[model samples]
Target: MIPAKADIEAAYARVKPYVHRTPVLTSSLINKHINAEVFFKCENFQKMGAFKMRGAVNAILQLSEEERKAGVVTHSSGNFAQAVALAARTLGVQAYIVMPSNAPGVKKEAVKGYGGIITESLPSLEDRERAAVEIKRETGATFLHPSNQMEVILGNATATLELLESHPDLDTVITPVGGGGLLAGTALAVHYFGNRCMTIAGEPFAADDAYRSFHAGQIETNTTAITIADGLRTQLGSVNFPIIKELVTDILRVEEAEIVDSMRYLWERLKIVIEPSSAVPFAALLRHKEQFRNKKIGILLSGGNVSLSQLPF
Candidate 1:
């Protein structure tokens, strides 16, 4: 079920002590470049260096004592793995992460540093799921989807809730789409709290299942995951897709080059390090410049987990 405003509120209260209240930053130069007043909710500075911490903490905290004893398992490429690992460590629970073998080395190291036991799999969704299931069976771990659980979705909404609280007058809010957790949560927050703010999603052209799904009125899978935004390669799940379809105003697709350019631009202009997935929204704004001209928009900078050796710029 889609979590209600009350659920989001409770999640925020539950996770408040654990996660950082990441800042809302404005860049005059970016505003001028886009011809709009832009506010960036910098989740790049969040705990575990990403917004996933909120969801991870919320999910872990909701577990029963018995369940906590068994611990939790989840499959993720990077950010969510580290988030879950850190949250579990903080809560005195074990975390088992099933990661693709091709995931960035830095991110894998971060997961280990956060006390996660890692199981590597081939870079395929099927392989990742199989590994997670095997781990769950062996360890009796509760399987938590990185972005599809109700608690996780509400947890993600807290970031948008915080954003709208700080900028109630925003006409629109934008976030990058992957498994739809953050975007769906942003939609719910805007629906419940904003003064008529609409939610738009920025998606990569290479991993454009979200854009296609938004238009097709059903979940769509990518034929190939070739995006530099490795975090965005996953398809939408059953739980978050309906919420996204109903509440999101639009999904804009940006090319790989645009994502890379936007990532570099944000780092150079705002002096903030944002990964390619986080840059997708800004790239969309640039692609549809005239549509949002002279409007107040809020962008969720989703995360800052990037490999220095693989800098797109």
Candidate 2:
């Protein structure tokens, strides 16, 4: 098991100098509309255009010089691909990126531009992992799990640390649940801070594994996930599952239409362009406003990588 508080604190120290101190935005417009006092963690402004960079950089920096020389391997829907690619390039190591054929072209180009070697595979996380494993055997590369490793979790936790530090009075934190890295990390931070802040995980209505898993008491990863939030399509991983089971309190599901509209809300109201996956938390709030009304809620915006033309407006 990962160290609960101290290790997470050390993780902040280890990766702080390398990552951006991402800003938080509180909007009165959101508060009036949703009737909730809201704080937004703008991770869309993070390096490589998402929160994955925090994990990727911290994981890369933790490696020994020999390990760095040996290089790294992983798979992603998009953001983590760019994160690992950019981090690996910075460390003068190779990044073997396995992605689905259906991944956004913008992300594919960004990965290649960062000098990452790209491999196309089926969209399933298992298939992507299998491909990366095969490449690892062939190239002697260390497999860096996108959201399953302790280091990545610690890196993800920093966002919460920053948020709570800036907005000490936040009563709750809402974030999207993919492989559970962000949720796990955020929960750890909330717990360590000795704050009663509730950690709420959000998922697409179409792919509600995390929501189901929370109720089932154990994650059911065998089923295929179906959602337009391609970034959140992965099942919970070994490291994240236990942490989430222990830390997360609840899960919310949001519809596809709400996701798109939430993305638009960010673009119009916040003047920020965010992807569908990142919009799920806001969509959850919009869909179930009464649940969060009059409460001081913190929303973690997971990323900003959408193709403008893809918006179904």
Best by TM-score: 1
**How good is model 1 by TM-score?**
0.99
Candidate 2 structure quality by residue, lDDT tens digits, 61-110: 88898888888999998999999999899879899999998899989999
lDDT of 1: 0.94
- Taking all chains together, each candidate's TM-score versus the true structure is 0.99, 0.97
* Top lDDT prediction, candidate number: 1
Candidate 1 Cα errors over 4 Å, as ranges? none
Clashes of each: 0, 0
Local accuracy of candidate 1 as per-residue lDDT tens digits, 1-313? 5567798899999999999999999989889989999999999999988999999999999999999999999999999999999999999999999999999999999999999999999999999999999999999999989888888988999999999989899999999999999998899999999998899999988999999999999888998989999889898999999999899999999999999999999999899888889999999999998999999999999999998888977
What are the C-alpha RMSDs, in order, of all predicted structures? 0.7, 1.3
